[model samples]
Target chain A: MQFLLAFVIGGIICAIGQLFIDLTRSSVTPAHVLVGYVTAGAILSALGLYQPLVNIAGAGATIPLSGFGHSLAQGAIKAVQTRGLLGAFAGGAEATAAGIVAAVVFGYAAAVLFNPRS
Target chain B: MTQSQGQGNLQQQKMQQELQQEYKQLVKNVKPRPPVLKNTILAFLVGGAICLIGQLILWFLKKEGLGDKEAAAATAAIMIFLGALLTGLGIYDVIGKYGGAGSMVPITGFANSIVAPAMEFKREGFVFGVGARLFTVAGPVLVYGFLVSTVVGLIYYLIR
Candidate 1:
């Protein structure tokens, strides 16, 4: 049931993007959509609305760019509670550091190994 | 003389219209049509598969005694690793070409976005090229992501 929820929710999010791609006149780029999702996630999470969806949907809620936003908000809020104002600056970065570091390190290694196609 | 000049201008306008029509036809013949339906299905299937893999990893982490939060983090890391590795091998681009948003909608796509530009700019040298372009796609995401979170945190702190 959890897996089903994850699949359905995750598939719907991607489908919305697909629909935009299929129907639109190519006005919106994928990066814009991704950033929009992340921003929405952050806002929803800050308003305390995203947690329930994450609770129910699991990876469906967490794997999308919005989930990245949720993580940033959650980290900031948690840090603010414990560390005060300083947490706002450090918290989001600390929380997302794993994903960011992985991207940079792996990206650099991949850059070394592969030649880009023109 | 005035009447002849008007006639000459009308003839030039007709020739211009014909040239425009010919150019439109030439472009129509050269433009390639993408396989939209196939791409949509591939995106749906591949995007779903990547999420399913993330879910499976989360489940495994939980079984190994990690709490939900810890498991979530671990799953994200593993997915990023896989995404980067696949991108390094040039496999993800094929998947990206076919899957479109399917491959991109997930965190794995984020990894690919970072790796792809870095690989492309590597020829420009490491510091100026790979290091600089590493965040081409993700830089905006991080900047805005952190900025918004900080504001939200401040607001939450003030209110509560």
Candidate 2:
């Protein structure tokens, strides 16, 4: 059941992105969509709305770019609660550090080891 | 004679407009339309499949006794690693071509964005090529995501 929900929700979110790309003739590139989704996720999360979706969808909600935003927002909120305003500066990056660091390390290794095909 | 010349100019303008419209129609007819419905279905299936994999990873970690948040973070890292590895193997692009936004919307896609550019720009050398170009696609995501989250955090702090 959890897997099913995750797949469905994740697919729907991706489909929305595909539809936006197709309908706009891709005037909005994939980069824009990715960045936009994260921003939207952060805003939605800040409003305390995205958490319920996260609760329902589990990895489905969290695996997408928006989940990253939720992590950032949630991290900040948690930090603010415990450490005061100073937490706001450090918390968002702290929450997402694992993902970001993994991407950088793995990404650099991949680039060094592999060549792009034309 | 002046009045006649003005009338001819208007006629010429009308003819140009008609020609331009005809060319537009011709181009519209020539261009093949994208398979929107088919693409959307593929995107959904592919995207969902990726998420399902993530969910499985999350579940396995939880079963191993990691807390929920910790499991989630580890899952994301593992997924990113897979994404980078697949991208290096040249498999992810094939998946991306077929999956489109389905692949792009996931965290794996984010990893692909970072690696693809870095690999492509490798000929220019590591410092300027791989290093600088690595974030061409993903830089905005990190910047804006962090910026907005901080603003939200500040707001929450002020409000609560």
- Choose the strongest candidate by TM-score: 2
Candidate 2: residue B39 lDDT (0-100): 93
Q: Write candidate 2's Cα lDDT for B1-160 as tens digits.
A: 6999999999999999999999999998998878999999999999999999999999999999999889999999999999999999999999999999999999999999999999999999999999988898779999998999899889999999
Deviation from native of the Cα of residue B153 in model 1, angstroms: 0.9
lDDT tens string, model 1, B69-152?
A: 788888888888888889888899888887888888799898888888888889899998999888887888888898899998
- Distance from true location, Cα of A112 in model 1, Å: 1.4
TM-score of every prediction relative to native: 0.83, 0.91
- The TM-score, computed over Cα atoms with residue i paired to residue i, of candidate 1 is 0.83
Candidate 1 regions with alpha-carbon error over 4 angstroms:
A25-27, B1-41
In model 2, how large is the Cα lDDT of residue B45? Answer: 98
Model 2 sits at a Cα RMSD from the real structure of 3.2
Which CAPRI category fits model 2? high
What are the TM values for chain B, all candidates? 0.76, 0.84
